[model samples]
Target: MKFQLDEQQGGNAISRHDGQCVWVNGQPHRASLLVPWRGEVQPWPLSRFEDLTEAHFEQILACKPELVVFGSGARIRFARPQLYRSLIQARIGVETMDLGAACRTYNVLASEGRAVLAALLIDPE
Candidate 1:
């Protein structure tokens, strides 16, 4: 479940070494136990929010991921205090890293059969 990404046809594509699944951006090629983009892929999960708003909290709760990796596109940022607390309450671990690092982390964790969710944003230009 090591995922290698490719820039194909002007969009991002994901390829996994173990052939478990493939995704373009966050959309899975087939229905998977892991749901990508359960919410809007941009501001909600990918970015560091000011607070754990109801919608954001609900989305993460629904995912029930053992770990949630936030790819802040190109930088690392701390989560809002409320958001951090909510995740802790849900017994989920959180990692905030740059997009590339987040991607790598997600692949490794997913390969280990951990329920992992990633929110990555791609620079359009």
Candidate 2:
């Protein structure tokens, strides 16, 4: 689906998302990715939820976001707290949801100028 928000809001907001792909600032991205409120949109190297590792969460620390929205593919699946213990230690909040919801939530927080990141997992086609 597509999303509408003021372009002037000034942040890396999710512009569209569907079963197959996600668009960041109108650029289509088919792989899993990281969308920060403001900064580069990173490609997350995770293709399956089951393959998640602690190092995945650790990599996010470089962005130092206040919160992270984890999109666990097409369904809402929670990762074990231990996998993200690093984030907990850093006091960064993490929320898990289906891919679509994560996109929407990330957009809202990004538009509000919150330091948020969307760590989305998209299975390879």
Candidate 3:
């Protein structure tokens, strides 16, 4: 689906997303990645939700986002707290949802100028 957000001065906003791809700044990306409100979009290097590890959360920790919106592929699946223990310890909030919701939520927070990150896992078809 396509999205229309009041363009913020500078930040990465998700313009569209579907089952297989997500559009960031009008560019389509078909792999798992980390999208911060500002700065370069980095590849997450994860193929599936089942393969998630704490190390993955650690990567996010380094980004220092106030919150993380984790899209668990095509479905809404919650990861175990243990998987993201480090984040909780750091007081960084994390929310999980299906791919579509994650994309939408990320756009909203980003547009509002909040420090948020979208950790999307786009499973291969």
Question: What count of clashes does model 1 give?
Answer: 0
Candidate 3 residue-wise lDDT at 122? 98
Q: Which structure is stronger by lDDT: 1 or 3? A: 3
Give all TM-scores, in the order shown: 0.58, 0.92, 0.93
- Per-residue error at 105 for model 1, in Å? 0.6
For candidate 3, the per-residue lDDT at 45 reads 85
Candidate 1 wrongly placed segments (more than 4 Å)? 1-13, 16-54, 122-125
Quick one: best lDDT, which candidate?
Answer: 3
- Candidate 3's residue-wise lDDT over 43-111, tens digit each? 998998889999999999999999999999998989999999999999999999999999989988898
Colliding residue pairs in candidate 2: none
Highest-TM-score candidate: 3
The lDDT of each candidate is: 0.52, 0.89, 0.92
Model 2: residues with Cα > 4 Å off, grouped in runs: 1-4
Candidate 3's displacement at residue 44, Å, is 0.3
Model 2, TM vs. native: 0.92
RMSD of 3: 2.5
Ranking by lDDT: 3, 2, 1
Compose the digit string of candidate 1's lDDT tens values, residues 30-123: 2112223232332343223333355565566676777877654445656565755767888888788866677667666655556677755433
Candidate 3 least-lDDT 10 residues: 1-10
